[model samples]
Target: MTPLSHIRNFSIVAHIDHGKSTLADRLIQSTNTVAERDMKEQLLDSMDIERERGITIKANTVRIDYTAKDGQAYVLNLIDTPGHVDFAYEVSRSMRAVEGSLLVVDSTQGVEAQTLANVYQAIDADHEIVPVFNKIDLPASDIDRVAEQVEDVIGIDASGAIAVSAKTGEGIVETLEAIVTELPAPKGDPDAPLKAMLVDSWYDPYLGVVVLVRIMDGVLRKGDQIKMMQTGARYGVDRIGVFRPQMQNIDALGPGEIGFITASIKQVRDTRVGDTITHEKKGTDTPLPGFKPAQPVVFCGLFPVDSAEFEDLRDAIDKLALNDASFSFEMETSAALGFGFRCGFLGLLHLEVIRDRIEREYDIELITTAPSVIYHVYLKDGTQMDLHNPADMPDPSTVDHIEEPRIKATILVPDEYLGDVLKLCQDRRGIQLDLTYAGSRAMVVYDLPLNEVVFDFYDRLKSVTKGYASFDYQLEGYREDNLVKMSVLVNEEPVDALSMMVHRDRAEMRGRAMCEKLKELIPRHMFKIPIQAAIGGKVIARETLSALRKDVTAKCYGGDATRKKKLLEKQKAGKKKMRQFGKVDIPQEAFISALKMDG
Candidate 1:
C-alpha cells in the first residue's frame, strides 16, 4: 500500500475565465498524469458541454506522481472545482476532501465576487490556501496590484504568491513546488472502521453505478460488504477504482485515497453524495461528514420541438441526473407545451448546462420556457405548492395570501453605474440593505424578489454598465409582498408558456421591454402576430410586426406539374424547420437569439 506521507491533496478555486482549467491542464501534462499525445485541453472537464462552455461544472480529482526539487516522489491529488456561484454548494462539499486549495486569481480582472466567496469558503473549511495570480502574460495583467489585493483580502503573506500565465506555461514549476511545500499530507485513522464520503457518482453502462469517494478512515477493499449510512442498504463492492483523471480499477482503497467503487447498485437513488460508506461487520460509529443535497434556486418547463420526442427528453434527463444531482424534475404537461417536465436547477447556468448537455450528448432537440424562480402561495385550504409559472398559480381569489421568493443580492459595480443600478433595482422591488466601497467600485446589497430579477436583469445590468458589474446572490426565503400575475399575448391569445407573476411596481416598463424583445424574436409566420402584455386581463402594452406573406410566393410553380411538386416539397421542408407555437411557427434560433437581446 502507498503511504499517506507521500500524498498531497488540493483544489483549484477561481472565477470564470480566470485560467483555472488551463493551469489544471498544464499541471496534468507537466507531471505526466496523462500522455502527451492524448493530453486534451481542459482534460479534467471530461463532459462535452463543459469543454464547449469553457467552465468546470463538476469537481474532478486526479492523482499525479511528481518528483520534487528535493528528489522526493510525491502523490498529488488535484481537484478541479467549478468557478461559478451556482456550484458553490458542490465546492464546499469537495473542500472537505482536501487539505489545501490553490486560489487562482486573474491578474487582469483582479479579484471577482466569486473569487472572494470561494476564498472564504476554503478558509471556513479549514484548508490551507496557496494564492496564485494567473494570466501574468496578458498585456493588461497587473500582477503586483492583484498580488496586493490578494494579500489584503485573503490575509495571506505575499512572499509565496506565484504569478503565472497558464496559457504560456510560466512559473508552473514554482507553483508545483509550492504545492509540495504548502499542502499537508492527510491526517486520519487508517486502521479504524471503514468510513468514506461519496463526493460524486455517475452511472456507467459497462460497469453500472460508480461512486467517487474520498476515504477518511480505515481501509476499503473489493468484495467487502458495506452499508450506506443514510439508506441502510447493503452492497458487496465489486471493484474499487482510483482516478489518474481516468478511472483506474484497483483491488482496494485506503485512508486519504480518492477513488471510485462499483457495486451492483443499479438504482440511482441508492448512491447519494455525502452518504457515508462503512463496513457492515465493524459497525463503528465513525460516520462521514454529510452535506445537504443542493436546493434548486431556479425552475423552468422544458419540451421538445416535436411532441414525438417527449420520451426522448425524459430519457435524456434521466441519464443527466445520473451525474448531476442538482437537477430536479417533475412530470408536467403544459396546455401549450404538451408533455414535459418542470425542471428545477441550482441557478441559471445550471439550467443552461443541463439543457446543453441533454441536447448535445443525447442528440435530442428541445424548446424551453423562460427560467423562473419558485414562489410560495397559500391556497384556500392552507396547502402550498411552489409555483414556477403563473399558469400553475391558483387564482388570486383562491389564494388567501401570497409570498414571493427573496434573494440577498451582492453586486460590485463601478461608481459610474451606481445611479442606474439603483434605479434598476428599485424598479424590480429591490430594497437596499447596505453599501460599501471597494476602491472605485461600490459594493451594494439588496433584498429583492427572485421573480423580478430572473428576467433580463443580469443582461441589462451588464449591458448598461459595459460588463463591469459582478453579481452574487443567496436565497433568503419567501417574504410577503403585493404581486400581480402577468400574461403575455400573441394576437390576443394568451400564451401559458410566457406568463409570470411579478411585482406590480415595475410591470409596465418591464412588460414593454419584454414585449419588444418577443416581437423581435417571434418569427413572422403565415399571419401577422401582435405581442401584448396583459395584467389582470387588461392589456398594458402592445407591439406588432407584419407577417411573412411572401415567403413561399417565389417557389410557386406557374405551369409545369413537376415544378409544382418540387415547390411544395421545398415549402414543406421550410415548414419543418419552424417550431409551432399556437398559430405562429417560429424558427429554431429565435428562442436562443432572443436571450442575447441588449434590452
Candidate 2:
C-alpha cells in the first residue's frame, strides 16, 4: 500500500460541456492507468447516453499511480463527477469520497451556474479546490478573463490557477504536479474500527451486487462479514477490489482508500448509496457521516406501449433501479394508460436519462406522462398530506390551503440578454433575489415555483437567450400558493394520468392549451368526441373533435330522385346507430403527446 503522505484524493468538477470527462481521460492516460491501445474518448463515461450527450450522469472512481517531479511515487484516487444539476446528489457523494477538487472552468464560457453551485458545495464540505481553466486550445479561449472571474465570483485566488486543454494534452503534467503539491493528504487511522461509506452501488449479473466505497477508517478484505449500518443488513464479502480503470482483485483496502466490494446480495436496495458499511466482527460503534437518502423532486407515470408489456416494464425498472439509486417507482394504474409505474426522478435531465435508458436497454417503447412536482395539501381539519400525483389530491373543499415546492434558481447569461432573461423569469412568477456581474456574464438569482420550471423553462430560457444562458436550481422548501388540480376528460371520462396541479391564474390558459393539443392528437371516431379540461366539477376549457365522415351517396350516381332520398334516409339511420354504440379508442401516443404541451 502507498504511504499516507504519498496519497492524494481528489475529484474533477465543472459545468456541462466544460470537458470534465475528457480531462479524466487525459489524467488516466498520463498515469498509464489504462494502456494506450485501450483508451477511448470520455473513458470515464460508461453509459452510451453520457458519451453521446457529452455529460457525466454517474460519478466514476479510479486510482492512479503517478511519479511527481520530486522523483517520488504517489497514489492518486480521482473521482469523476457529473456536471449537471440533476446529478448534484451524485456530485455530493463524490465530494465526500475525496479531500479536494479540480474546479474546471471553460475559458470561453467562464463561470456558469453549475460551476458556482459545485464550487459552493466543495466549499461547504471544506475541500481544497484547485481552479483550472480548461479548453485553452480553442481560439476564443480567454484564460486571464476566466481566471479573474474565478477570483471575483468564486472568491478564490487566481494566481495559482493552472491552464490546461484536456483535448490537446496541454499543461496536463503541470496540472498533475499541482494536484500532488496542493491537495492535502487524507488523514485517518488504519487501526481504527471499520467505517466505510458506500457512495455508489450496481447489480452485476455474475457478482450479484457490486458496491463502490470509501474507507474512512479500518481495513476491508474478502471473506469478511460486512454490515450496512442504515439497513442493519449483513452479508459475507465475496470479493474486494479497486478500479484501476478496470476492476482488479486486491487483498485488502485500508483507511483513506477508495475501492469496491461485492457481497452475495441479490437486491440493489439491500446495498444502498449513503449507507455505511462496517466489518461485522470489528464494526465501529458509530457510522460515518453519510448523506441522507436522495429524495425525488420530479415525478411522472411510465406506461408500456403495449398493455401486455406491463410486467416487462416493471422488471426492467427493478433492474435499472439497482444501478440508479436516485430513481424510484411504484405501481400506478391510469384509466387512459392502463397499468404502469409512477416514477420519480431528481430533475428533468434525470427523467430523460432514465426514459432513454429504459427504451434503449430494455428494448421497450414507453409512454411517459407530463412530469409533476410534489405538493403539500392542508385540510380544513388541520390535516396535512403530501401529493405526488395530481389525481390523488383531495377535493379543494376539504383543503384549507395548498403548498408547492419552490427552488432557488440561478441563471448565468451574457449581459446583453439580461433584460430578456429577467422578463422570462417574471413571466414565470419568479421573485428576483439578487443580480451580480461576473465578468461579461450576469448571475441572476430568483425564487420560482418548481412546477413552473420543470416543463419548458430551460428550453424557453435558451430560446430567449439564443442558447447563451445556463441555469441551475435547488429546492428552497415549500410555500403556500394559489394552486388547483386540473384534469383532462375525453368523451366525458377523466384521465388520471393527465391531471396536473396548476396555478389558479394560469389554469384557464393551460387548460385550453392542453385541450387543443389533445384534440389534435386524439383520432376522430364515428361520433364527435368532446375533450375538456376541468377544475373540480367545473369545465374551464373544451374542444370538440368532429366525427370522421363516410360518403354514402357515392353508389347512387345515376339513381332517381326517390331512390336517392331513400338511400340518404337509410344512411342517416346507420350513422345514428354507429354514433350510439361507437367508443373512442384513444391511442397511447395521444396521451403522451397531449401532456407534452407547454402553455
Candidate 3:
C-alpha cells in the first residue's frame, strides 16, 4: 500500500474535444500502468458508442504508479470526466471524490463555454486546479494566448501552466511531476472509522453491482460488512480491487486510495452514488454530504413498435438505469401507441443517446413521442401540480396560468457566426442577458425558455453557426408564460401523443408546422382526412389530405345529366358518412416522423 503523502487524486476537466481522454491515456502510458502493446487510444472509455462519438459519457478512473526525480514513488488516481453539460452530474460526483483537477484548455480554441462551466464546478468543489494547455502539436496552438485567456476569463494564474501535446506525449513527464509536486495530497486519518464515498456504481453481468469508492478514513477489507448510509443497505464485500485500466484484486484499501469493491449486491439502484459507506459494526456518526439528486429537465414517452417487445424495452431501460442515475422512467400507456415508458433525460443529446442505446443494445424498435418540458400549472382553486405530459393537462378554465422552465444559455462562437447566433436566440424569444468578447470569439449569454431550446435548438444553432459554436446552459427556475396546450386532431379525433404545450405567441406557427408535417407523413385515407392543429377548441391550422377519388360519375357519363348529378350526390353523401366513421390508419412511422417538427 502507498503512503498518504505519496497519493494524488485528481480529475481531468475540459471542454468537448479538448484532449481530456487523450491526456489520461498518455499519462497511463507514460507510467506503464498498462503494457505498451496492451494500450489503446481512449483506454478509459469502455463503451463503443463513446469511442465512436468521440465523447466521454461515463466518468472513468484508473490508478498509475510513477517514480519522480526525487526517487520517491507516487500513486495517482485519475478520474476522466465527461465534458458535455448533460453529463455534468457525473463530473461533479467525480470532482467530490478527488482533491484537485487538471484544467485542460485547448490552445487553439482558448476558453470555450463548457470549459468555463466545468472549471466553475471544480472551483465549487474547492479543487486545486492545475492549468494545462493541450493540443500544442497543432499549428494553431498558442500556449501564450491560452495562458492569457485563462488569467483573463478563468481568473486563474497560468504563468506556470504546463503546455503539452497529449496526442504526441510531448509533456507527459512534466504533467506527472506537476501531479506529484503541485497538486496537494488527499488528507485522511487512517485510525478513524471507515467512511468511503461511493463515487460511482454499475451493474456487471457476472459480478452484479461493481462499486467504485474513495476511502476517506480507516481501511476497508474484502470481507468487511459495509453499510450504505444513503440507502441503509448492508452487504459483505467479496472482493476489492483497483483499476490499472483493468481490474486487479487487492487485499485492502486505506485512506486516500480509490478502488472498486464488489459485495454480494443485487442491483445498481441499491448502491447510491456519493453515498457514504461505513462498517456496519463501527461506523461514523456523520454521513458525507451527497450530491443533489439529478433532476431530469426533459420528459418524453418511448413506446415499442411491436407491443410484444415492451417487456424487452423495460428490461433494457432497467439495465441502463443501473449505470445512469440521471435517466429516469415510469410505465405509461398511450391511447394511440399502447404500453410504453415515459423517460426523463437531462437534455436532447442525453435523450438521443439513451434511445439509441436501447434500440442498438436490446434490438427493440422504439417510437419516441415529442419531448416536453415540465410546467408548473397553477389552478384557480389555489392548487398546483407539475405538468409532464400535455395529454394529461386539465381544462384551461380551472387553470390560472402556466409557468415554463427557463435556462441561462451561454454560447461561444466566432465573430462571423455571432449575428446568426444572436438572431437564432431572438427568434426563440430569448432575453439577452450579456454579450462579451473572448479574443475573436463572441460569448453571448441569453435567458431562453428551456422548451424552446430542447426541440432542435442545438441542431439549429449548429447549422446556423456552421458547427463553430459551443453552448452550455443551466436552469434558471420557472416563470409564468403565455403557454397553452396545442393538440393535433386527425379526422376530429385528438392524438394524445401529438399534443404539446406551446407559447401563445408562437402557438400558431408551431401548430401550422405540425399540421403540415402530419399532412405529409400521414398516408392519404379513402375518405377526406382533415388534420387540424388546435389550441383548446379553437383550430389554429388545418391541412386537408384529399382522398383517393374513384370516378363515380365516369360510369354515368353517357346517361342523362340528371343521372350524373344524382350519382355525384350519392358519392358525396357516401364520402361524408365514411369520413365520420373512418379510422385514420396512421402508421407507426408517422408518429415518430411527425415529432421531428423541424418544419
**Tens digits of per-residue lDDT for model 1 on 1-599?**
56888888899998878888999999988898899989888899888778888889888888888999999998888889998888998788889888999999989988777887888889988998888989888899987777877776557776678988899899999999999998889876888888888888878898888888888889999999999988999999999887888778889888888888888888566788898999999866867668778998878888898899998998888888877777889888876678998899988778878888888888888878867887788888879877776787776778777888899988888899999888888867789999987667788899988876776778777877899888888888888887778888777777777777767776787678778888877867754577898987688889986656444546564777787667667766654454244366556566555444243
TM-score for each of the candidates: 0.88, 0.96, 0.96
TM-score of 3: 0.96
TM-score of 1: 0.88
Tens-place lDDT digits, model 3, residues 328-428: 99999988899999999998889989998998989999999999999999999999999999999999999999999999999999999999999999999
Worst 10 residues of 3 by lDDT: 551-560
Report, for every candidate in turn, its global Cα lDDT versus the true structure: 0.82, 0.89, 0.92
Please tell me which predicted candidate would have the highest lDDT against the true structure: 3
lDDT of 2 by residue, 245-278 (tens): 8999998888789999988898888887888888
| Clashes per candidate, residues 3 or more apart or on different chains | 0, 0, 0
lDDT of 2: 0.89
**In model 2, what is the error at residue 298, expressed in angstroms?**
0.8
Candidate 3: misplaced stretches above 4 Å?
Answer: 551-573
